[model samples]
Target: MTHLSGGPALPQERRLVTAVPGPKSLELLARKNAAVAAGVGVTLPVFVTRAGGGVLEDVDGNSLIDFGSGIAVASVGNSAEAVVRRATEQLEAFTHTCFMVTPYEGYVEVAERLAELTPGDHPKKSALFNSGAEAVENAVKIARAHTRRTAVVVFDHGYHGRTNLTMALTAKNMPYKQGFGPFAPEVYRVPLAYPFRWKGDAQACAAEAAEAAIDQITKQIGAENVAAVIIEPIAGEGGFIEPAKGFLPRIAEFAKANGIVFVADEIQTGFCRTGQWFACEDEGIVPDLITTAKGIAGGLPLAAVTGRAEIMDAAHSGGLGGTYGGNPVACAAALGSIETMKELDLPARARRIEEIMKPRLAALMDKYDVIGEVRGRGAMIAVELVASGTRDGAKEPDAATAAAVAKACHAAGLVVLTCGTYGNVLRFLPPLVIGEDLLNEGLDIIESAFAGR
Candidate 1:
């Protein structure tokens, strides 16, 4: 197994030479507080100097286990050789030509690969962008132009992006939407078939949620006015909630019947993160449009909107693009990332991650009442926390316990992240290149945190 990640071969072990945030990190933290905006948040205060494989080496000389993978962007490891090599070559050749003015072969090549890799065998087309929000916004634009409709439908417990329209589509309020109202109009919200929180079994939940969504569109929004129905195959930022079995297919059928575009927001679940090239492939969903980012270009800022050729080409000439859309360097990184995923069989790697992680998380649930559920597919896994000591443990979300456990893990040199509408989920997104030994060590830190709690 080619386990040697980019930088100096970091030994697969945890080493804390100083306190979690030692003198150097503390100094930088002070500087960050003075210069950085207050709205920006930092999960762990430590300053990272280098990261690869399963470890992040901080400026303080602490080798912390990376469980978040920079929010699932570093699936091939932080500095995979191919990504670094291609990006370096591209950088040396030319950093930017502003593809709008003078296009390059790299950008076209990346889009071609996306056309081939994204779900569906139908004739497809792609347009690249700078972020997931950009891709989603463009997808909405294309759908509206094609259908000549104004209304767009999204689901509860689904997060699209942080931009104006995406924030309107997002369900959560406190952080993402609190004081940012007066959002874009013509966006409608519906129910998702969230299995853990739904009223019945998986099949029943799927059936009921589909009916509820259809009913809402028929009455509240009016199906004729709708342009698209967008959803995450495995909803990220809404606690990694995977819809109940059969839910997506039913929704897709509804959209097809109504002439509404079906969009899969695969920002966090794409690029082999969910044991498949795209999460929509699991249920054979062929969306009219798909938004991708985060893991698409290693760690570079790149995203794309790929879909059926007819739908994607509906927008008129010069209708969609940005100043930095499909920048040459980011395109190079994306091509390298795709090559690495194929050569290394990262889809199988993600499945192996699930095999190792799900069992441990399930065991944790078995022992702790605070853990209400262990859910998600492949590497995109999460544990929902609920208040303990009650007969029905899943009744109340336990944000306090989740916070404490995250703090404990940070103190012990394990980088972990938390998410969910209620702030009660601990998400694990280890890099696909992470070694089993280092993965176990990070889990050990989590186990110790829970035991102490």
Candidate 2:
């Protein structure tokens, strides 16, 4: 086994050559414009040549620090040796056999690992998919089949996926759902406990919000008609907002009492992103179903829905699978990724990242008038930008300011990503393997950007 410590050395510091989207990357962008769909949002025009640990080398020959992690997909770091070797070896043997038809050992092994790693000591079962959206959609399907209900409840600022069903489940409406819906029905939205915005005690706010949601469901759709209450423990794209302290526990209690399946969407927060195996583990609340993707296979397209055995068994044998659901190569990559996560103690690494980031971010909050909030769990952190001193800091998000800051950071040879309904929050998902000095350097650049602004 290739140890995580044995990977190629990361660059000591960021270095930029040509402008961010240099000549070669500009040429590629031109080609991409002609060949690819315009709906895709490209943050930086620079094209990647290679990536390892926490740095990305562009085709332009610039070595840039990666704070985006391909939107939290590279938690195990880009091109991890174990993942690469396992994927290559699996590729040499066989690529696909359609696990539902001709099963493979890798597929079964991945499922077994998920069942063990996911939060809960109870009997568990898992099914694989190709993306987070598929995992979430299947969780709903299983919940509905088990509960015999039609309504699914998701919280405000929650992000599930882009599928029709998930679009309805998603909270934001503009980019994800604009012109794309006519969405699937039976989805309900409830308020989430965002302490930074809410005007009450944390526990009280959670209890009130959850009780209100439960009442609304019972009044409007009836609890008997609600199949599941799906949520992201720490909201990801909807501003990386961590739920209020008692919020998750309150929601779990509601789900337990109401017989509604609780689904924890850990796609962006899982695989040790939040210093825990799963974010829900922090509250010690075990959901009936869990959806995961992103870092699961260390950049390969693999997603999973793990849950109690009875709920998973509710779906008929042939009713729950895809042709490429558990592709052999992806499964091999997942096995390697899981092994890497355990052997390297990535969860401990995530805590180290938190230790490094928290104080710096808190300092930014104190210095920058535009920084309304600095929040996250572990490495899945974000800073929400709001215009200074408007309506008790409830000012609308300033996308222009955010764009400028992001561009400035990129010019300084650091890659950062901006996300939020209003495009005003900058999220950081640096690879857990990033060296402390490099991580501090990236944070320093961000501080400089805020200072200059």
Leading candidate by TM-score: 1
**Stretches of candidate 2 above 4 Å error?**
1-12, 199-203, 391-393
Candidate 1 residue-wise lDDT, 91-161, digit = tens: 99999989889999998898899899988889999999999999999999999999999999999999988
Best by lDDT: 1
lDDT of each: 0.91, 0.88
What is the alpha-carbon lDDT for the whole of candidate 2? 0.88
User: Could you tell me the C-alpha RMSD of candidate 2 in Å?
Assistant: 1.9
TM-score of 2: 0.97
Worst 10 residues of 1 by lDDT: 1-10
